[model samples]
Target: MAPQLDTQTLGLVFQSRPDILAGIQQAADTPARTTLFNDIASFVYERLACADAPDGPASKRRRLDIAQPPAQTHRNGHAQDSVPPAGSQTGALGADAAVADPVLLEVKDISVTAPQRKKYDLCFTKNFLYARASGTSVPVQGIVYPWTDIEHAFYLPVPDKSQAQYNYVLLPRGSFLPTAKQASASAVDRQQPLEPLVFTVPATAPKPGSIGGSSAKTAEAVSDTYSSLFNWALTTSLRSAGNHSCQLVAADPKLFHSVARQPHRPNEKAVHVKAFRGSKDGFLFFLPTGILWAFKKPLLFLPLDRIVAVSYTNVLRTTFNMVVELDTEGSSDGSSTVEKEVEFGMIDQGDYQGIDDTYVRRHGLADRSMAEQRKAKRELVENAKKAPADGEGDASAAGGADGMTELERAQQEAEQRLQDEEDEMEEDYDPGSDGDSEGEGESSEDEDDDDDEDEEDEDEMGTAED
Candidate 1:
């Protein structure tokens, strides 16, 4: 007797990919069948766990249809058809209202730095972190970061702002951005891509003497109280969620310090790079784990594991660009590897040596540009070895041309041949003059033939007289 597979899983596998299920069914042995079944089941589970495309009109209509029955059944209690009775509405909404998330940590008067600058009271709940408008207890309908989705947390310094820093959290790519359930429908409709959680503390503490300063001190104290708690909660959540890859990064000056110097804090070193991503000026922090670019919209964190190599480009006396090449997962069929690049430019040359020694060399991230040049040279040598002997003489003259790609040289040769043909046609073209000269030569030859004929006739007559 053979062990039976789960009927539900088998049915789902068959519905999703019949060929896969068929292969599982036609396995060579019992063990093979079990292995295939397990693999297919796992793949199907992961696929279903991923977020699906946005709900379509048909799905929305179906949901409306399903929701109408309960309301229609309770419509009799209502005096008007347009509005439902309070009891019915409360009953419909009570399911969600019954269980509220317990707040773990609450920080006040925090400001968002990226996407936009807005003041919000940051609340850390057991399952999520919500950013609500200041003095508002009600959760706003907007982006919420779930504890399980957060892959990393960083506490980094603000450039040129002494004793100022910000903390932000990053999510793994392809994860869905959670929305506050209590928020209104209008708020829910503003669905955007998963944005990084970017918030910064006030740069300066209020003076001790004023009333506003006292209030600011209170807010700062509240923020300080929960800062450590936030880190602990996030770490615990990551552990419980079995996300070993996730980390809580606190920038340590010992590992990799910023090359930029601060006159205010000459002894203290920051962990950041003053660089520009397009027109946006931002700071890059080289953490023990990876690099983080922040204080702007589209905040990016490149994990060390995902980074393939770091290469410098546009090298000059004043500034240069740094391009980070990232390794991406291949396609489902595993036919080819994928790569992605993020470039930050206008890095000061003054800070180059320190960064080169501390971050780039310490991490052993060799410059891929140099490697690529060497690879190109080796490829050229190999191509020369394989080149046919018939083009040996041309090859010497084509030394500079050999640097060009095969297609480019071929194109150049084609253009040159075309120009030569055009020049030959220009030299041969005598227009109507050549035609007139040929006509005169033909007339002279015809007159000469007539004279010869007359002479021959004269000779014949003389012979007859004799």
Candidate 2:
């Protein structure tokens, strides 16, 4: 089963990063994180474990079996099964949190200098859905000090009405602090900060490898690779000439961060995303290994507006693709209001090698060399029955003469397959065609005609008697 990292926890983790990492180091050095602070350590270690699990999930564990033919069962006249959105099973997470899975949060480009020197990645998921962070203010001595532990105040946005952006996120300072009470009501009560400090990753200069989606030059570059990668991942047999969706290529730590709404850590790039253009609610997901780009089918098209969550994982250390989801549904004034909707995730190797194959073919030198192996096996089996007592070049005998070799096994399988096809052909009973069932239907039609003739004769006799 896949490990479901609570995005709620991730959001908190994102807010408390640099400090959280610092705290973890301190705890490790002094064993400060005792029983009470285990959750923080759990979050960190589990992340490390996921990264180390190689040959585990994303290492092309099983050869893609979907490439096999689809089987049609006899009891399949009923419609195909559908996933019940209302009653679907989730890993016991909060409903609201699951639905808003950071679909558009980019670690916007890092800044390098003074007016632009501050470096911060803009991390947001969906605009309609808000990402929250609560800053905790722990009372250490006389004054209240912000714990900046992931449990700080919930970072809700303070709407800047004029600017259409929230000016500040309110902090309910009293909730987490210790309070005092007395019989005469003379004891002091702890109060949270009236105004919690609003720490914005100040809009600084874009860092060396960050990307910005606002600029035309930048948007084109970001989509150029990200879109291509997505398209290749969704590569299907329905591929037609000049009929292709804009492929999403993975970003390679360049101009992408400049515009990313969320900048991720060097360690946490083990996630990927898929957008189904045709889904009703709009998207579905697989863990890091579950999404294979080579498995292209209409079953995967996601609607642009319906993406609810993006849980990325670098299950293996080899994570690729830097990118964001863009909301291209432009607004009025003939100008775009929401210029860029960005979030970042990583794709693993099983997905990459598979995706890479299709791309190479498109550019011209792709090879699917297994056809020769299959052909040789077929010829070897055909010759095996005629070989001498001392088996020589028979494909099956060549494979292994030990009573049952792969070549002989394959021949048996092929014979059975042929027999099954013949049975299917014999079973073809066209209900309305010239079969026994159709003959029975024709007999009923003749009986109806005879009855009609008798009725006409009776009417004529009655008229003559009158």
Give the TM-score (vs. native) of candidate 1.
Answer: 0.50
> Per-residue lDDT for 189-210 in model 1, tens only?
5322345666675434422321
Error of 2 at 212 (Å): 38
TM-score of 2: 0.16
Q: Number of the top candidate by lDDT?
A: 1
lDDT of each: 0.54, 0.28
For candidate 2, the lDDT comes to: 0.28
Q: Give the Å error, residue 93, model 2.
A: 69
TM-score of each: 0.50, 0.16
Clashes of each: 0, 73
lDDT of 2 by residue, 221-320 (tens): 3333432312221222112212133222222222111111223333322222332222222212221111211111221212223222222222223333
